[model samples]
Target: MITRFEELDWQSTPIGDLTLRRRTEPAVGQEIYEVKLGDEYLMSSLFTVAEEELADLGLAAVAGDGLSVLVGGLGLGYTAVAVLQDARVTSLTVIDRLGAVIGWHERNLLPVSAELVDDARTTLVEDDFFAVMRSAPVEGRGGYSAILLDVDHSPRHQLDPTHADLYDAAGLRALDRHLAAEGIFALWSDDPPDDDFMIELNAVFDDAVAHVVDFENAVTGGMSSNTVYVARSRGTGSASLDSTPAHADKDA
Candidate 1:
């Protein structure tokens, strides 16, 4: 008999305890993977629609080929793998604070591990995404065509306090320096569109918009949605969605 739940790996890091587990979802009767930091549920294999859109929509806004991209988070390798799907992307750099997560992809512990590991364009960097951005421009590096971020749950709530500044005006201005003149920045959020964050983006980028991504939630047997904010265009508006998550007012 197969066990319903299994713990794959666990580790102690500077942030907190990290854990990767597999559980058989009774509703689907299939293996589902999950990652958690301490007691906080980070990500699960059940819903990845929005994670994928972060790459699709972000890269879609880029006007040309030979795109240099940067992905801020590498959880489950979904976002990175999604980025590789675009043939126009020439380079991809993924920064994650946790080495354990990178190891998961390198060791083929996750479902999308093979895709990320085999891709030559993918560079998985173990570092603080925020700290790297602070000096990325001053380091004499070429700007990325698109910077896709999915690290935090939302602008209002951060996994760590250090990320809060990145959503502000000065922080955004610093990040703007790392972008090409036409480069775009896309962010994934677990909450609805934040007006204040939009203001911050518009302050630095030419244009910005928040897109609501709706997908089926098998766990809740209902629809769930996530917000993807894309900047560096020529307009501003929130792509509204009529649906909402089944849980609390905070979608995250």
Candidate 2:
């Protein structure tokens, strides 16, 4: 259909460029934003199989009832939007470092993500996720059912400089505090972390599980996929999501 990027309120940044594209299909009836580095298309809010899985895993953690979710990034708002779909989510607080991202949703992206905004369960926070986590210790932001963080590429491969610290011990511990007794912390990575990362996560949480998802972009025809790391408050596997399927290890 030869879409023009200019009409879509293109946002330019040093890391990459974002185009807020209108949903060309009537059935979809939503806007989708795409991130591109130079000419290389990175990702979009459309067809987010892995993001949805994060929500599913989170809902399963707290038995899917009266849930409060904290999402760390607003990339296309896919994860936040999916979490809003579940009626169990009583409140969802989303944090994004970039004000431009939040603006896109409130300005051009709302038609596609309107349901999430109208749900009365969503709160958008434009601030550093790290600062937000640090404040959690005394801010009484505790008791989240799920804390889903889809930041940068992943801890192993960071698309931004600030992302590296997220995988460190301090970051994980901060995440731990905001979670309820049985809450689940779900993290999405562009690639698998080294063995040491897994060991570190296991040490922080009572029980931790990793799911490697094989994603082939139907639109761009890319072969790369990613993994999602899930951990619970207690070491006894309190998160209700099924442990990594036996086959996932081989895939990892």
Candidate 3:
């Protein structure tokens, strides 16, 4: 069989150049979708276990129906799609800094795009997530039931150096304002758990914890892990789910 690789689209954004591509994996005989910023790989369809887990673990912490959510990144739409899988979710707003990434989904270039586009509960917004968090309340909803983020590689390892501030105490506080009382804030980190980030998260939110998600790395044929940090807004309600395992780190 011939290995097929194609560049689906590319664009120049305020931060950097973005590219979307699709290729066939020889080992799995599966078509994989990927997004890149300059020379860095942003996301890939081949490894989405952590992305999906971000949504699942985030929503599991929240308790209620008619939930509203804000997804910080729209890579392959895995996280957003996972959020929609829960019947309690009523609205989903996915924000991506790169317009080209959004266009790929709109054009049906991604495997999960059609499902994401057709869902009445889903809305795609093109904007810097950190900027939006610092600026205004999203959609004037006052706050959402959950905020799931998967934009940067990690708090310590950001795709853009400017994003470094977002991992700080002030930045976490700003993000907290966008959440409803006791609302959930979950982030995906490519690196293992960081204790210092957890301390900062705890200072901002009422309770914060991290979960380590392990998956098989297709390329290396080895186990790799990602961190999912979930925190609750300062409020009176109690968390419905138990804390994640002890091995998990908080944020980055």
- Give candidate 2 regions above 4 Å deviation: 1-7, 12-32, 37-42, 108-111, 136-138, 220-224, 235-252
Over 174-199, each residue of candidate 1 has an lDDT whose tens digit, in order, gives: 66666777789999999999999999
RMSD of each: 8.9, 9.1, 7.6
Candidate structures ordered by lDDT, highest first? 3, 1, 2
Models 1 onward score TM values of: 0.90, 0.78, 0.90
Off by over 4 Å in 1: 1-3, 136-140, 233-252
TM-score: the better of candidates 2 and 3: 3
Query: What's the CA error at residue 32 for candidate 3, in Å?
Result: 0.9
Q: Write the per-residue lDDT of candidate 3 for residues 1-252, one digit (tens) a residue.
A: 798999988888777888888899887789998888889888888999999999999999999899999999887999999999999999999988777788888999888889999999999987778776654453556478999999888889887787787798777776776788989999999999999999888888866889999999988889999999999998532222122222211121
Error of 2 at 36 (Å): 3.5
184: Cα error in model 1, Å: 0.6
lDDT by residue for model 2 (31-136), tens: 5556554576556656587877777775665665788899988767778888888888889999876667788777645444676566688998776775556443
lDDT of each: 0.84, 0.69, 0.84
Q: Is candidate 1 or candidate 2 better by TM-score?
A: 1
